[model samples]
Target: YYNAIMACGLDSQDALEIFRLCIYDKQFIDTATLKDSQMQLKGRAASGVVFVANAALSVASITGDMSVVSEVITDLSSIGAKMNSESIRHIVRALGNIGDCEMILALLICLRGQDFANDLM
Candidate 1:
């Protein structure tokens, strides 16, 4: 279901539906299913991070959930720290969708040592 969302390039609403289903539907996704997803997410490149981060931020913004925002920020920070120039560029673009000022600030701070900051101004 999550893979379908990624493959189809669905909008946030669609992606959120899948995310909710993944979180709530006990019969749909088991422990191993979730662990596999987590592993895949951890191994994803910058583009994948951008997609997931964007979806997470969108969900947080719409729901006004700070916890979700924080989680997504953490994921973005972790992935962004390891990405190369092209990946960082995707992350920067996705950052624009994030509504939380604090998250944006944190992302900026994390990007300081990277070359992407030079291109920002």
Candidate 2:
């Protein structure tokens, strides 16, 4: 539910705070009082986290917000979270859109070993 909102390019302090909660505090869990183990599954809870990452990348690319992009990258890296190939594409496209040398270096270092050669070339 929350992921849906964020994926639509909704930028707000509340959204970022909740994103941090999901990444650092494991915010997503059983909403009801039952505390169902299945509902609280780590993978299930993290499903939205990936969506948020993808969405954030898209927003960063369009808005050219280096700080936002850096924050997302740092948050994902600190947690050892892996982005899907689509997210990588977004990062590459952002490099083209924003042309930030620092971001290029940081992302290349962060994504070391991933086959982004075709995109770079």
Candidate 3:
């Protein structure tokens, strides 16, 4: 749930505060909570594609969970999300935050079909 909130592009400080609160009460935390967050975020129809892509990268940075990040990326691709050079820059920064070489490599592979390679170069 905390991860998903951060993935919604909330400010880092706000997300951290919510994370602490959620951790303080473990009784209501469950897998369904995570699913709910994802559903809610995905249901947002007005957000830009770049925002959603960055949110996915933020999720990767916060949780270090590849599965959730992969799901977000896959969903974005499936929806044909429009990402520009700026979005790539933001994702690179988030990847730096993750500091996982394997994840970076995986992202590279996952993005091979996208048009941002030139932007990355």
Candidate 4:
């Protein structure tokens, strides 16, 4: 599913479906499943991450609810140390894309007092 998104030029809609499936489906059993799809996003060269990030934003845009977006950001922020740089960047970018004022503030608060500078900034 992730690979398919990349093959399609990082199709946001497809990526969103993958994100929804990961969240709603109990059948998906993998370490990556727990992480936001954005966290696993790769660049255009890598492709996978690009689609996943686009998908997340598309989902947020369509729903107008921050549930999925917040989950991804919170999960990513909480587990920032465990993720790679690219993953963390994607997670942050996802948050930024959502453009939710409340969520952005909350994330900022959570980031406070943390030693890691890159994830929050």
Candidate 5:
């Protein structure tokens, strides 16, 4: 399911939105699904990481639990995913969706070091 969702191109955002609505209840999240998503995103590029993170953030938004989101971040960090400008945008939006102000601020700070503050302006 996670792979299929990630494979979606132009419809990815819409699919994720619908998935978020369907899984608004925490019961919809299970150990198997979480592992499946993790496996699908493991060793992927930064865009794939962002894709999976966006989905994870949607789940976090619904359940108000950061466990999955944290795991995704940890996996990405360990692998040092090659993030590009677009990847940063997706991650920021995901963090914002889940109201992760601390992470968002941290990301902004990192971007500032990369001289993207002007772009934000």
Candidate 6:
């Protein structure tokens, strides 16, 4: 996604808005309070590039097809430290829909670097 964004020679911010409009043109998430999302993920480029993580997570959760994004999810988790707290939170919440213990173990591996406190989690 970021690659495409860069390839278009866009100024990042404007291009994101334009891209969102092109994709979610008919659908709106509403301007009301973002109770479930963090504002930081709006523009924060995790992995020093882009965190299209939200799009990947949403597709998996909404479609109830974990396989749709399992690899991407794992990649995101593997580089969890490079991501913001909100991005990781998004991944966890999305995976929560699956309620799988294997995912817990996978997340634990990533969370280990985040905190020994998380060892209790």
lDDT of 5 at 34: 58
TM-score of 4: 0.36
The candidate that wins on TM-score is 2
Q: What tens digits encode model 3's per-residue C-alpha lDDT throughout 9-121?
A: 53444443444344334454344345444653322231334343455546455545444445555555654455455445545556666686676677677777666555465
CA deviation > 4 Å runs, candidate 4: 8-10, 30-87, 91-110, 115-121
TM-score of each: 0.37, 0.55, 0.41, 0.36, 0.39, 0.38
Worst 10 residues of 3 by lDDT: 41-50
Q: Which candidate model has the greater lDDT, 1 or 6?
A: 1
Q: How does model 3 fare in lDDT?
A: 0.50
Instruction: Compose the digit string of candidate 1's lDDT tens values, residues 28-100.
Output: 4355354545654322333333444455444445445445445545544643323344434434445555455
| lDDT (tens digit, per residue) of candidate 5 on 46-73 | 3333444555444444444445445445
TM-score of 1: 0.37
Go through the candidates in order and give each one's C-alpha lDDT. 0.48, 0.58, 0.50, 0.46, 0.50, 0.44
Flag the better candidate by lDDT, 2 or 3. 2
Ranking by TM-score: 2, 3, 5, 6, 1, 4
**What's model 5's lDDT at 110?**
69
Q: What local lDDT score does residue 23 receive in model 1, on the 0 to 100 scale?
A: 43
**Distance (Å) between predicted and true CA of 84, model 4?**
6.9
Cα lDDT of model 2 by residue, 9-103, tens digit = 73633444555666654444222213432343232233445556666766666656656667777887776655566566667666777677787
**How many steric overlaps are in each model, in order?**
0, 0, 0, 2, 0, 0
Quick one: best lDDT, which candidate? 2
Question: Weakest 10 consecutive residues, lDDT, candidate 5?
Answer: 40-49
Residue 89 error for model 1, in Å? 9.0
Kindly report which residue stretches of model 6 are placed more than 4 angstroms away from their true locations once superposed: 1-49, 73-82, 115-121
